[model samples]
Target chain A: MLILIVEDEKELALSIRDYLKGIQDITCDLAPNFSKAVELTELYSYDCLIVDLGLPDGDGLEIIKKVKTEDAQTGIIIISARDTLDDRLKGLNIGADDYLTKPFHLSELQARIASVLRRIRFDGKSILKEGVLEVDTVQRKIKVNGKEPDLTKSEFNILEYLITNKNKVVTKASIAEHILGEYSDMYSSYDFVYTHIKNLRKKLVELGCPDYIKTVYGTGYIFETA
Target chain B: MNLLTKTSLLITTVALTVLMAGGVIFFLSTKEMINKQVDKELISEMHFVMRSFDNLVHGRDTVFYEELTIIPTDEIISPVARFRDTIRLNVFDNKYHTYRALFFGFRKGGNNYKIEIFKSLIDSNTLIERVTLVWIGMSLFLIVAIYFLNKLIFKSTWKDFFEILKLAKSYDLKKPHKKVLLKESEINEFASLNTVITQLLERVERDFNNQKELTANTSHELQTPLSIIRMKAELLLQTPDLTSEQVRLISDILATTDRLSRLNKSLLTISKIENNQFRETEKISLHEKIRSLAGQFKELIDEKGLKISMTLEETTIEIHPLLADLLLVNLLGNAILHNPVENGRILLELKNNILKIANTGDHIELDKENIFHRYFRQSKNPGSTGIGLSIVKKICEYYDIDLDYRYRNNLHTFILDLSSLYTS
Candidate 1:
């Protein structure tokens, strides 16, 4: 899967690219500004697009609309540091799949992206099942030996994404962008992703689900069926 | 009701009263003196008649009567006769014998003889009537003269006064070079008044222009740096491989940008209030406004672990909402911001057209008089912009609202007298 991040912050874009590398078989591209972001959008097709609101040349919302218009099938999420309720409502009203305020956890972002993908591509159905380990995406219900186990929305989404993309590495940036949406701009420090991943892992282990989501140190996450 | 009309009316009333009173007194007293003179001459003629009759009767001389008749009686009685047509006389003998005497009187020598003489007072009355008529005519003429003189004084002086007044009313600061044209009056007071007014107008125009320019320049200067800071933050976010420290720095920049924006807005608000740019009327509920402000600041209050209590009486007050809001915001925000953390408590009470907000805080360091001065923040408080209380004071002054601040037992209380809301 390919993901494109068009942001004016070069450091933030690179960090996002680095985080995506941890996800197996996933590639990422970066665009540093409005003009460059526009160029990248025209030249590439991606599974998801992360767009920031403030751009060097123009407004980020304009770019998001243009990109969405160009590729209606692409899943777009807005990331903005502007936490005003009006800004959030406006971004959502303009067909953004999710709006994220700044200073958010990366794992939360990853869960959101997975959820969006499942909803759009897989019709929110988990196709990966092994014996007693069955993940239900539509209901966010997990079944171990035909006994349903309770899961939070974040936990269920995290488990489902890891299982669907088994034997692959998912970077912290991808996860952060997915859950935190545009808010990752505020958390450019990249430390919040560790806590959310840690929590998700601890929950999955306690539930007796397969422990496949792994932290690739200094990079991202990897889910293995071993 | 205008000054000129009022003053001139008063002058006319007083002048007319004095002139008419003097005219009446002069007419009455002059008539009395003329009557007294007529009475005195009549008495002297009566005496002369008695003496002449006595001589004639005693000497038994018929020549005395003839001599008296040749004495030109017109001279002796003309003054009285001029006022009367005829003079009548009566003579009484010792046995009460009576004779009708004309012009003069005669009497017997040994036998007691009494003589009485009277000139016709009808002519005297006629003369007195003529004199009164002339006196009244002269008085009328004098009153007319005095009235015209008063009118002349009022006309010249009032014209100049009105001209100065018109110039003052039409004075425009935008056209400072246009001099108020006043015809120079000989009256020193009016001339001096004109000079003073012209000087005052010039000074006012100068000060107004200077203030406008200062505000314009200050606003421009502040806005420029604010814009630059915002743009710089946006640009900084675009840098590659930014460390965690760099990210933190950018966040700081953004926060400062927000503060600067707020400052700019507050300054603009103060300027607007100072210039009286807002309309003077609005209907607002003081209770509802305080409730709304409390709700808005609820989070900050909660975060500081402060307990807030409110007791508001139901009342609908009318005032300018902008000024009222500004006043409330500053007072409440100040109370919240200055209070000690965890120990902070606010008591908001509104009743009897008074709003009192009290909060726990450090003791006020400065004298109360300096509290409302611009940029006069209390010592040892770093977070305050100092302009908040000043803005509150200005709003109170403009709306004629009374604001009082007091500190007691580590509690700072601000009282807003909303009495003007009802009266205005």
Candidate 2:
């Protein structure tokens, strides 16, 4: 997948590109200004565009509009420091696929990108199979060796999250956010995340699958199929 | 008293006093003029009588008086007269009326002849009385007319003033409104009042906005660098064969960066809320909203071994749905975080437009006043962002919703009364 990150902040944009490359097999480009971003979008076909609402040259929401006017199918994600509901809604209304506030976990951005790509390219059914583990996106079910396991809604969500982003280090915060929605802000500790992941791993291993969850010592957990 | 009432009272008193004084002066002046006229008439009549008497004595004038007295004593060589006011009998009307009489002593033909002549002063007296009465009546009329005219003119003249006063009274500094100036009147004072007040309000709003901008920008500008620091620490933690002390330091750095991110986000949230940035609202079912939010806490609640109950009815309310959700989440999280060590009980109820969330716990010993302030942490963990309740309080204030915290019987309850919430 080819992606363009339209952000002026050099370090943040570089980190985001490096993080994405480390986690997934994808090529990324950076545009430092509105004109350059527009020029790049014209010069090459992109699978997705990461647009920042605060650009030094111009308002990036207008860029979303301009880009969508030319190519309506380019998946756009808005990464902004403006977190108001109005700003989020405006971006979404203007053909942006998702919205993420700044100072966010790169893993959260990765999950959003994957979701947006699946939505735009696959047109709905997003299934994943790694070794003997499989997730049916349409049925919201998980199967091991063609046998389904009894998983609750949150358990299912967590499994799908880890399996899709296999081999990528996902933070505990990102996992909580992915499963709990906005209620993730209420977490005072990650003990709940540890318990949920332990239960999910037990359920999977009991159904005759190898242990695939790896903890990165001081950091969060990583789902490894390699 | 109010300005209008006080002015009317003062004006009436002054006008009445002046009218009374003028009436008294007018009556006295008119009485003196009438007396002088009466004295002049009496003198003229005495002269005429003396002339007629002289004529009769010389045998050249016919005189009606047939009786005369002569005295040869020498009291005066010329005529000496005295005048006295007396009431005499009127032969025509048979009613005694006031009269001015002139008595003169003189020597005629070497003998002193005394003549007493009296004329009626009834007509002059009646004229003086009538003139005094008319003056009093006119003075009273002028006083009443002036009072009414002053009242009517005052009300019409201050119409613009009252309008500007009303606008000032209703103006709120917190929620600024546009078009603060009234329609400019032709009067200079009223127009000046409108201009100054509008300019003052605009200045206040601009200054408030600038301060809010500073807060928002400062918080927003900190996010990128904090993210960089946090991500770098995260990347460093990824390297292999690091010592325990090294891991500890890098993780500490990561933890501090995370805390900073949360702090900055909270500050941004507060500024946005106060700036009236979140304006989207919808009709949301309290039951469904509560259920969905509570379900999100299922894992934590279960892991903590806490019990929560809900007695909710599906009442729909109009509010910013996101804020309503946030309010519920914060309150419930507070309940769980503050619950006792074991067997904690939480009871939630929504009845009669009041949302009551009661939890079983020891009294938190919160300062009733500063509990809602930013960075007020009661727990010893020192990890609490300490801004959750403050944000909830702000949201409640925005909606004019009444929020109260109380502890009794070791049960801390947060009550939100939604019935009295007003939109306008």
TM-score of chain B only, all predictions?
0.55, 0.77
Supply candidate 1's per-residue lDDT for B89.
40
Tens-place lDDT digits, model 1, residues B88-194: 34232223222222343233333333333333344445665787678667766766676667677778767877777787787755444455666576778879998
lDDT of each: 0.64, 0.79
Candidate closest to the true structure, highest lDDT:
2
* Per-residue alpha-carbon lDDT of candidate 1 for residues A153-216, written as tens digits (9 for 90 to 100): 6556556656654544444444544544432222223454565567777755676766667664
Q: Estimate each model's TM-score.
A: 0.43, 0.76
lDDT per residue for candidate 2 within A1-226, as digits (tens), equals 8999999998888888877776666899999999999899889888899998889998888888888888877889999887767789999998999999877777778878887888788864487777788888768898898889999888888777876666766667778778877666666677777877888899999998888987766446778877
Q: Kindly report which residue pairs in candidate 2 clash with one another.
A: B71-B112
Worst 10-residue stretch by lDDT in candidate 1 chain A? Answer: A181-190
True contacts kept of each: 0.00, 0.43
lDDT of 1 at B140: 65
Give all candidate RMSDs, comma-separated.
Answer: 13.3, 5.9
Model 1: residue B219 alpha-carbon error in angstroms: 1.3
Question: Which sections of candidate 1 miss by over 4 Å?
Answer: A1-226, B1-192, B237-240, B243-260
